[model samples]
Target: MIKGTVKIDAKICKGCELCIISCPQDGLGLAAQFNDKGYRYVELIEDNCTGCVNCALVCPEAAITVFRQPKPAKKSVEKK
Candidate 1:
């Protein structure tokens, strides 16, 4: 059950790394690159996210958001 989840507002983000440390599950990280404002952005790693939304709550910039992945659709079988 692997998925990508992390919503960030680049314009509002100041790259403080507060979200990085706040994550109890270690989901958030500082990306290798910077945004248009030259601020290092945050990203989510699959093995890391527990969807606690700790990062979202601690973010002073209101830049981070977490979402749960949608469940897979079930298949229908035909009967004779």
Candidate 2:
């Protein structure tokens, strides 16, 4: 399976839950601490992200960035 992750710009996030709601994997959540803007920022709470870009698409501040790593290709055995 393809692995995924996200980076959130805490400084710019306005604590909107739109990204959290749009996340199919339920990987996002609000941080315990507040950002520079005094808003609780969204963060990756789980490792089940699939990099679907759903969170990024729904983010009004464009603070979320998703990265996807492709599954490794399998090696085939040679027939003698």
Candidate 3:
């Protein structure tokens, strides 16, 4: 379960919504404010991202970049 974040170039984004749809964790959404091009860009809406890069692969404009970090390992408990 590698967690990650997405960086989107709002100015370069064409508001195609492909990245938003491709995200598996539903981590992305349209921004509330418009970009320099007067188009609402995609943004990260949640922290449960898995760094799958699905959004980046589907993006036609190549406006999205993903950064991933390894998820912390869970502690194991011993039975008494």
Candidate 4:
């Protein structure tokens, strides 16, 4: 399972809700408070993000940034 997260630039976000709708994991939501631009910004509502980049792709303002955790390394067995 790939664990991931996202960061949103609240100052520039216009509360378009495009990212929220594009998110497949339901990890994003609009903030209750407004930003300096007087628009509610997007936020991570769940910890189930997979860094799919869907939200970022749909964001017109390009305010969302997705970060994915690296996969674990596989252990190798040495031949005796």
Candidate 5:
């Protein structure tokens, strides 16, 4: 499985749910606390992330950054 993590710049977030809706794994949520601008930031909730970067693409403020682990390579069998 492809594993990944997300880093959200809470200060830059504008309380937009675009990232939440763009995530396929539902890994994002609104935080209980508020930012400097009084807008709740995005937080990671579920662990079913696939590093699809959908959230980052939809974020108008560019407050989200996704880090994805590389997938394992397949091995080939030699013919005897």
Candidate 6:
């Protein structure tokens, strides 16, 4: 599994829910509170993330960024 994190650029978000419907994992959503611009911005429910990067793909402003954690190192097998 990828260790993924989603970031919402509050300055650029227009409170639209298009990314919400586009996310296959339901990883992204609209915030209940409004920002300084008097508009609601998107936020991430990090625990539910599947790292598909769907939110980034759907964002019109290219404001979202997803960071994936590197894979864990595999253990070496011992000779029997």
Q: Candidate 5, which segments miss by more than 4 Å at Cα?
A: 73-80
Candidates ranked, most accurate by lDDT first? 2, 4, 5, 3, 6, 1
Report lDDT (CA) for all predictions.
Answer: 0.72, 0.88, 0.83, 0.87, 0.86, 0.78
> What RMSD does each model have against the real structure?
4.8, 3.4, 3.7, 3.6, 3.6, 3.5
lDDT of 6 by residue, 1-80 (tens): 55578888998888788888988777777788898888799898647776678888988879888887655442222222
lDDT of 4 by residue, 5-45 (tens): 89998999999999888888888888999999899888898
Clash-forming residue pairs, model 2: none
lDDT of 2 by residue, 31-66 (tens): 999998899999999999989999999899998888
Return the TM-score for candidate 5, rounded to 2 decimals: 0.85
Q: Given candidate 4, what's the lDDT at residue 17?
A: 97
Candidate 5: lDDT of 73?
41
List runs of model 1 lying over 4 Å from the truth: 1-4, 69-80
How many angstroms is residue 70 displaced in model 3 relative to the true structure, after the best TM-score fit? Answer: 4.3
Q: Residue by residue across 6-63, what tens digits does model 5's lDDT show?
A: 9999989998899888888888999999999999999998888888989989999988
Q: Report the C-alpha displacement of residue 13, candidate 2, in angstroms.
A: 0.5
**How many residue-pair clashes does candidate 1 contain?**
0
Clashing pairs in 4: none
**Candidate 5: global Cα-lDDT?**
0.86
Supply candidate 3's per-residue lDDT for 54: 97
